[model samples]
Structures are given as structure tokens and as C-alpha cells.
Target chain A: MNQTIETMLNHRSVRKFKEENLSPEQIQMIVEAAQMASTSSFIQAYSIIGVTDPEKKKKLAKLAGGQDYVSESGHFFVFCADLYRHSLIGKWENADVDDSIMSMEKFMVSVIDASLAAQNAAVAAESMGLGICYIGGLRNNLPEVSELLETPEHVIPLFGLTVGVPDQKTAVKPRMPFQSIYHENSYRHQKDTVKQEMNEYNEAISAYYHERTAGKRSDKWTEQMAKMLQRKSRMYMKEFVEGKNFAKK
Target chain B: MNQTIETMLNHRSVRKFKEENLSPEQIQMIVEAAQMASTSSFIQAYSIIGVTDPEKKKKLAKLAGGQDYVSESGHFFVFCADLYRHSLIGKWENADVDDSIMSMEKFMVSVIDASLAAQNAAVAAESMGLGICYIGGLRNNLPEVSELLETPEHVIPLFGLTVGVPDQKTAVKPRMPFQSIYHENSYRHQKDTVKQEMNEYNEAISAYYHERTAGKRSDKWTEQMAKMLQRKSRMYMKEFVEGKNFAKK
Candidate 1:
């Protein structure tokens, strides 16, 4: 197999880390690698806040669904979809960059750009024999995170990533069948086959959960999702984001 | 430096790729790596269409703003933000994921999930000594791409990635100063020194462009962006995306 395929197939989330700080040079290298990613129209609408302070990490951990790994991790970075720089450029050019450009498409573009860059950094760390985990809980409190980062208009935190030296190894997570997600030529909205695949995936995930959770049968992916969706987790962040002057429409 | 970071830092678009066909196992590995990315609420709102057919690649190249690389690349995959899967799920459960669930927050989550996955696959390719380029031009004809891909409703083509062995080597692209994009707290917009950095970057890019374009001046990042933005790219894509059954209102 090609090296890329090998590395990708072997991916596993590393939550525990050795207690060691990353060198400044290493940080620069990783960030530079992230900067090399493709940006929409070269606007590069994203930013990464390298959080080094422990107290801040503690608070961040609390905000992010109480994930202790976030606070204890060696390097924590919050990636953001930032158009503030472009807005400043707009001010210089005296153009209205606020309204039309702040649509769903633009928002999605910036968020995706940031995530792509973060993933590159994650893979880079892993290739260096380091560990990484994506902290999606960062979105639990958008305004709080924005305030913590002192982010200005048109910039919102999308997610956080924790990187460090590995303290433990884990199994790579299994995914649903490709046919369930991949469509040929057009989308097929059938659920029987997908449901069957989900059931199998659920069993596999449940076994993994049991191995990790000390013989407890965890909720299936679907059940967990239904609960979270019904509970409307992080729903309040929507207004906070819009209130922060992003998503102008 | 770790191999992954080196790969990312050295990333340059490969417009030219060697003529080699990827094995089905390699393709599966890339897709699996993509699926492993963290999805918001575990909804997995993304899809990928791998295009290997020469005729389809040519048509895709033509549709994607005449980018010859699309046809020339050995492997091409279209990454999409797919809400259609969830729509089907909602139908099965006799429930609606609805407008509230499809908020900007949800949209951002799906886009990031898809992008992060794609980036992982890209890095995997790079680590394996392969070359890849992200094709943002895929958005140039969203409807056509959807039609060509047989994309169903609620799925939007976020971007395309072309991958293979490198047919030619390219110099690394220069980036804006770290300070310009990276902010301390909140955002400190409009700096006196940023202008100088911008000028430097412009000079660097212009030199690169000149070399690439046979002594012609390549406009600075901002200048190039201004020109691109003036074209009102993706102006009508908003309506088209929403029309495809994605809820915007």
C-alpha cells in the first residue's frame, strides 16, 4: 500500500498524553504546514489560537463537555473561521464586505478551511509520533470561546485540537460501510441497507465502548445522536455566533 | 521534523500528475480515513464520489472552470456536504431534522467534518510520496457537478481533490505573515506593520508568479483576491444550494 493510505487507515484518536511541552520551533513548523493548505480565493479565512495557559485550558475543558484531555493535553489549539481580516481589508477599500459575503456558503467555506488545516496539523503531529484528538466540544459555548480568544467580528471558533506525545495506544475506530455514505451518480435515500450497516457498526462500536468503558454497553451511534439531537446540544451557540456579527444574513 | 508535518509544509499544488491507476484497496483506505473524522452529532453529513473514468474526468474538468488538472490527475474525488442522508434518516424515523437542526451551526459542523476528512486523506497521500491538489473550481458549476455526480438533494459539492504521483515538482507557495492571520485576543485589525508584511508577501508571490508565467507580474494576494471577488463567484450558488432541498430559511 502507498504510505498515505497506510497512515490514513491506521488513524486512531490519542486522548492521553505524556507531560511534555512542544518546542516553539515545532509549533511554527506545524502552523506553517497548516498555512500551506488550500484556501477559498486565497482569502485564508481562518485562525488558530495556540492555548498554552493551564488555567485557560482548565476553563476550556469545562466548557467543552468536561473533557479532561483538553486541559491536560500538551498542546491545545482552537481553530476558528475568521473573516475579520477581510473585513479590515474592506474598511481599507471602503467596500461593503459585510452583507453578501456572510452567507451560509462563505461560513461553511471558512469553517471547512480551518478544519482542513487543523487535520493537516493533526496528521503532521501523528506522523512525528505524537498523539492528537479533535475537541468538537469547543462549540458548546461559542460566545464564551470567542470572548476567551478575544475574537472580533466575523471570527468564530469552530473546534479545538489537542496534540501531545502519546501516553497510550488505542484501536482505530471503525466506520459505517462505504456504500452507505458514498453514492454512485446520484443519492439513494434507502434506509434498510443503511440501517443494517448502522446496526453492525453499532455492535462494533459497542464492543469498543465495552472494552474502554469496563464492560458497559454504550448507546449505539444512532441512539446517542438521537438523544443529543433531541436535547438540542449547543443550540444556543447559533444566536451567539450570529450576534457576534458573523452570518450577517 | 515528522514526516507528516514535512509533507504538509512542503505541500504545493500538483497540476501535473504521473499516469498511474490507483488500486481499489488504496481508494478504500482513503475513503475510510475520510469517514473517521469527527462528525457533529455523529450525523456524518458528507459524501465522496471517486471519478476514474477518463470521459467523466474530462467532463468534470470542463465543468470545473476549465481546469485541465481535473482530467490529467490519476485519481479525483469530489467531497460534498451532504444533508441528504439526514433527510432520509428523518424520513425513516417519521421525524424532521428540520430548519432548527439545519442551522448555521449544523452546516458548519458538516462542512468541517467533510473537509477534515479530505485533508486527512490528502496528508495520507502526501506521506505515501504522492501528490495532490484541491480543486475549488468544483464550485464553479455546482448544479452541473451535482448533475454529473448524480448528487441528490441536500448535498452540496464543497470541493474536489485530485491525487496521484507527481509528474513535475513545484516550489512551495508563500503565505501571509503569521501575525496577519493569527491574533492575540479578539482581533486587532488594521496594523501598521501588516502593510509592510503584505508588501513583502506580494513581492514574494509576484516573483514566483513571474517565474511561473514567464516574466509576467503576478498580482499580490489581495489584488488577486479583489479581482476574483469582483467576478461574483458563487453568487447564484446560494439559491441553487437551497433549491436542492437544503434549508436556509
Candidate 2:
């Protein structure tokens, strides 16, 4: 396999990072790589905020459910789904129209754009031998994050990224078998593989935990996933979008 | 910069394509790479449906606002924001605890997960000398597309991708000046550079279009964006997300 493909296939999210700093030149190059990512309809509806201040980083870490890496990583950025620029652009020269910019689809384009750019930066950092992690906890307290970032209307803090040299090593956790998620024609229109494939995956993952933790913490994938992850979190996303004037009503 | 970074920076959305099919090995490697992408909290909340039927492809092409490449690429896949597996996991295990699976945050997690996986597939495809185009137009007629795919509730058809050999070559269009979107501390907390940078970008993009199209079209970034793209499209996204039983209420 080629270098690019190899880097992508061997992906990992690193939480513990060494104490080091990225050079300005290196950060510039990474940001340039992010800019090169394709934006939807060329809207370029995203912005990256580099948090260099230790105090701010510390507070951000606390805000993101005390994810220490948010402060510990040598570099951190909050990717915002931004439509303020489009509004600003509308104010200039396009005075006669800007109604479509306020639609739900347009707002989603910004969110997707932010996600795409952040992923590109993640791949770029990993390829450069730097470790990285995404802090979804940024949304653990959404309004506070917006206040902290001082984002204007039409902008929302989608997520934060932490990048640094790795200070810990970890295994790449197994994913569901290829056939389970990637299907021919359609998963629904085709066959029901969930019961069968998931049963097998449960075995593999159960074994994985048993082997990894010496049988100390053996939790099945579905059981643990349902109990842990499928919780009622971020119910205010609707409010968050609406409060920010991104409701596209 | 390294080869991987170069590959990413050189990416282009290929709409035109050579009529060729990808070998099964190539497709497997690409999906493997997609599976390897990092998921939010390892939930892996996404599924990919490869649409190989010419009849289905034709219908999808029409559904996506008549985007010809949806059928022309000879290979197509739809990325679904899936929480169905999580719900099923809840059903089999934590029957009483399925409340959280329907949260808005969980839904956003799935959307972001799907996008991350799709972008990895795009990068992997580009790495192997293949071309890709993301059809957000898949959402142009979202509910119908879902019915056509037979996807159940809590599964939204997020977007579609087309992959094949490139039948056209295009220059990399210019992005906003790096400093405009890449802020040192914050865009709002710091200074507003949008006007200045956009002024320069407008000139750059105007020149790009002028040269590329040989004066057949000349539209500034903000002007064209305001004139053409700012129309209110996909206003039903709010209702669609709410209707999927994935609502965060």
C-alpha cells in the first residue's frame, strides 16, 4: 500500500501527549493542508481557533469534561461551524438577497465542512508522526463553550482537537466485520446481517477485552455500548442551534 | 512536505469519470481504510451501502437533483447516519434504557462518524489514483432516498459518494487566505479579518474563474455566492431530523 493509504488505515486517537511544541512553520503547513480540503459548494464554512494560552486551555480542558489532553496537548484548536462569514458577505454587495443562507441545509453544510476540515487536519498530523484526539466533550457544556470562544451568531463550536507527540501507546480497537457495515446494494434492501454478524463480532470483541484486560473488565460490545453510550445527552442541540440564530426557520 | 500530505493537498472532487469498475480488491481495501477511521467514543455509529444496481443508480441520480455522475461513475455508495444497531443492542440488552439512544447528541455523533468514515474513503480512493465526488445532493430529496434504500427509522441517508477513474482534470481552486480562517487565539476574541482577506480572495477567485473559463464567466466569491447559492433550499431538514424518531425530545 502507498504511504497515504497506510497512514489512513492505521489511524488511532491519542489522548496522552508528550510535552512538546509544534513549530510555527509546521502549524502553518498543517493549516494549509486543512484549507486544501474540499468545502461544500466552496462555502468554506468553518474556522479554526488556536488556543495558545495556558489558562484558556486549562479552562477548556475542564469544560470538556476535564479531558486533560485538551490542556496537555502542545497544540489545540476548536473547529466552529461558521456561517457568520456568509452573512458578512451578504452584507457586502449582495444586499438584495441572503435568505437562502439561513436554511437548515445551509447550516448543515457548515457543520459538515467543519468536520471534513478537522479530519483532514487529523490525518495530516498523524502522517507527520504527531498524536491527536478529538474532544467531543466540547459539547458537554455547549453554551459555555460558545461563550468561552466568543463565537458570534451563525457560529457553533462543533468540536475541539488536541495534537502533540505521543506519550502513550495503545492498540487499534477492532471494528465490526467489514460485511456488517459495508454492504452490497443496501443493508436494509438486501439481507438482515445484524443478528449474525453482530453475534460473531460480540465474540471477537468479548475475547478482545478478555485478552486485553486479563478478564478483569470483560464487557460485551452491545451491552456496554447500549448502557454507556446510548444515553440522553445534548438534548439542547435544538436549542443550541436555535439560540445561535442557526435554526434556519 | 511528505507524500501523504501532498496527496491530501492535491485532492479534487471528480465529477466526470472514465467508465471503469473497481476491482473487488480495490473496493475492499478502500472500505477497510474507512472502517479504520477513528469514531467518536468508539461507537462506530455508521454504515455504508454500496449501490451497484444500474437501475437504483439511475433513480438515485435523479433524486439527487439530476446529478448525472451519481449514475455515470459506475460505482456509488451511500453513507447512512445509523443508530439502529445501537437501538437493537439496547433492545437485546438494556430494554428499559433505550431512552438515550434517541438523544440529539447521539444523532449528531452518528452524522459526524459517517462523515469521518466517508472522508477517509475519499482520501484512500485518491491515494490509489481514483477520483471521488461527494454528493450532498443526496439530501436534496432525503426522505424519498431513504425509502428507496429501505432504511428504517433512526437511519438518515446523509450523503452519497461516487468513485472511479477521472475523466476530467481541473485546477485546485483557491481557498480563503490561510490567516483568515486560521486564527491565532480567536476570530471573534481577536480581530475581524474577514473583509480584508475576502477582498483579496475575491480578486484571486475572480481571476481564477476568468482564466479557467476563458472569460465565459466572471463572478466574485461573495457576489456569486449571494446571487446563486444563497437560495433557501432544503428547508425541510429540521422536520426530517425530527421525523426520523431520532428526535432528542
Candidate 3:
């Protein structure tokens, strides 16, 4: 128990990787751990596409805003929110899949299922002295990723995971103060929590970034938020997902 | 390492409790583990509301389809996909939060972040001999869960989690043959994977259900899928979330 909690606490994203790949047994074990994660309604609404082919990895890296780790990692996988198989099962049972599968709630459930499983996979990898980084950049060119991966409708690529031997270490990024996130029996207004700690957190974040980047970047949390929240990214995700039959046809 | 792996593999959702509440220290440790989880772009886009109030728990159990377990656990929490803090930070920085925070991609990021943190918390709890069940039924009536919890705009409840000592054990549910979910190199069509194992899986599920229910229910996986996929549930989620200011004003 102590070891597992320690592993979860000591986690850091590894973007650089050694050339070595994971053994088949390691991949198998990590995947089984992922499978054991609870799915909503036992729907098991997710799929994983492991990409070891160099050509395909290169294609994904380029499509994912040129993240070199996507192509250079020990193993790369695209975790998809998949309802396609359930639809097939519905057909086998002569049921109207559109009625249940097309709602926003189900779509949200699928996202939770996929995300939870991916975290388990990550923890499993970390427990074995391996490192992993999530590649949300994959969303930058979702249409192309869909085309390249041969992903069918109702299975959208949510994010990519790069699992590898760590070639570089990253600082454990500073999180906001505890009170800012942990609420009591009822939700407290921001003034009573996050606002109280905002400046302290901002300074801590600034210091962490300053040391990590050798003083090249020393922006606080709010400064980073300003820049990140100004750009409208993946604006077409709704239409893309809905078009892929995630919505009523 | 092996012990942690085994704990993850042996996971089951325990709905019944032993009438024991966790110590304050244990809950603190679990929440810290959750804070240590990786968030996209360091956004940390999630909030957890711990609900120990009997009235709130009873109200939630009713709103969440009368799952008595919601009100009968050692600890119950509603996890929210929070962009509220980011908007506040944007206001502090004088940036236009509406353009970036309102997009579907950002919404998806928040969902992934919140779900990942919740999974970590679940694992942390399980490592300490506590059993956890995810309460997705919270979405059944989002507005009420929000109202009961006093969750404000830009903060939406995604799911709930119940943690307690296990008083009952459920059968380890069988998953689809892994080839149905895991693909090599790229996505494989259902005809090439899931169909090959569908009938076998259906029979296994039927038998399992028969044994568990003493033949009171002998339905195949296909029959279950038929019933599960015919009802549209929580269709109001999109509008509810958008109303919470997660969408552009």
C-alpha cells in the first residue's frame, strides 16, 4: 500500500525516452491492469491501438504537432472512446443503438471509462520503473489521426500515451494549494478557497518553472492560464465526434 | 511492485459498507494522491466535493436513481470537471476566457483530467483496503446534483465515488477477449476482431449471469446489450453543462 501511494505521488511526465522498447510481457501486464479498471455499467467503452510501426508513429508524431516523443518512445498507443463495438452488439441483438449511444451523457461516460483505464495503464507502467507521457497534442489534427489509424465512427482518438524508459527527468510540477481544490461537505465559493491561495500558488509555480527552464520562463500559474485559455483549440471536435455517429443520426 | 499490480488487478466495486468511516488522515492522503495526478497543460481542471451530510447524501441517492449506497458509505464525493478556476485566473490576467474555455476540446480536457484524478484517488483508497464504486448515476439529474451540492457555474459534476469497507463481494466480471479491445499498429474493424469472439462471449456471459442469479436471469450478453442500448439516458447533459458557463456566453 505504501509503495503504490508513493508511486502515484512521485509521478512525473517523461518526454524524452531511451531507444529500448518494452518487452511483450510488460505490455501484456500493463494492458491487463488497464482491463481491470471499472467501466460505467460494465460497458467497457474504450479501445487501445498500440502503434509500434515506425512509419505510422512518425505520421502520428507529425499530426500531433510534431511531438518527437510520439515517434521515439518505447511504445505509443492511441486510447479511443469506443462505442462502435457496442453498436455492433446492438445489431446482433436487433436493438436501436442510436437511442442510448447517441446521448451526450453516454459520450461523457465513454470519456470517463477511457480516461480511467488509461490512468491505470500509466500507474502500472510507472510501478515497473517505466515512464509515460500523455499526448493531448493528438487532438490538433484529429481528422488526420482518424484517417491514419483507420478508426471507424463512434471511436474518437482522445489522447496518445508514450511509454518508454526515461531518458530525461521532469520536476514534479507544483499543484494549487490543498484548500483550493478540496472542498468540504458543500461547494464553497472561490473567494473563500482558491482566492486565498492564488498568489502563493502562483509564486510557487513561478519558482518551479524558473528552475526547470533555467530562468528562460518564470511565469506564474495565472500568466500561463491567460495564454492557454486565449487560444480556441480543436474547435471542430464536437462536429467531428457527432459526425462520427456519437450523436443521433 | 507486484503487490500494487495485484491490488489493481483484483479491483471490484463494493456497493455495501461495514458502517465504518475513514479517519481524517486517510481522506487527506487520498485527496493528496489525487492532486498529484497529471493534468493536461498543468491546467489541473478538476474539483472534488466531499459529501458527508446525511440530508445531502439522501437527496443525492434519490436524485441518482435511488442507489441507497450513495448515502451508506464511509465516504462519498462528487467529482466535478472544473473550468471555473481557470476562468477566474483569466479574469485576474485580463484575458478573454470565453474563447478558449468554451470549446469542446477544452471540455474534453477537463473531463479527462477529472476522471484521471478520480481513478488515482480510487487506487489510493483501494491500496488501504477500502473498496470503491464509481457513481455515474449522478448524471441522471445533473441540475439537482449541482443544486444540492451548491456547485456553481463553470463547475459541473461528472460522477460520484463511494468508498467504504466491503460487506459484500461481487463476482469478478469477465471482460471481452482482449483482442476485441486491443489493436496492434492501428485500428482493426469489428469484423476482424470483436465478431470473431462475440458468440463465445455472449454464451459465457449468459452462463455467468445464470449462476450468479440462480437462473432467475439467463440472458445472453446480446440480450443485455439490447436492453442497455435501447434507452436514451441523461440527454440533457449538453444543455446543462453549457448552462453552467462551460460554453460561450
Clashing pairs in 2: A100-B231, A231-B100, A232-B100
Ten-residue region with minimum lDDT total, candidate 2 chain A: A186-195
How many clashes in each structure? 8, 3, 0
Interface RMSD for candidates 1 onward, in order:
2.9, 2.2, 1.7
DockQ, each predicted model: 0.46, 0.63, 0.72
Flag regions of model 2 displaced more than 4 Å: A95-99, A189-192, B96-98, B189-192
Q: Give candidate 2's whole-model lDDT.
A: 0.81
- Identify the runs in model 1 with alpha carbons over 4 angstroms from their true place: A1-7, A93-100, A210-214, A244-249, B53-55, B90-96, B184-186, B244-249
The runs of at least 3 residues in candidate 3 whose Cα sits more than 4 Å from the true structure, single-residue gaps closed, are: A213-216, A247-249, B190-193, B247-249
Among residues 3 or more apart in sequence or in different chains, the pairs in candidate 1 whose N, CA or C atoms overlap within 3 Å are A4-B124, A4-B128, A149-B186, A150-B186, A151-B186, A185-B149, A185-B150, A186-B150
lDDT of each: 0.73, 0.81, 0.86
CAPRI rating of model 1? acceptable
What are the per-residue Cα lDDT tens digits for candidate 3 across B147-207?
Answer: 8888877889999999988999877888777777789987888464577677788888888
DockQ of candidate 2, scored on C-alphas against the true complex (2 decimals): 0.63
| Clashes in predicted model 1 | 8
Q: Cα deviation of A196 in candidate 3 (Å)? A: 2.6
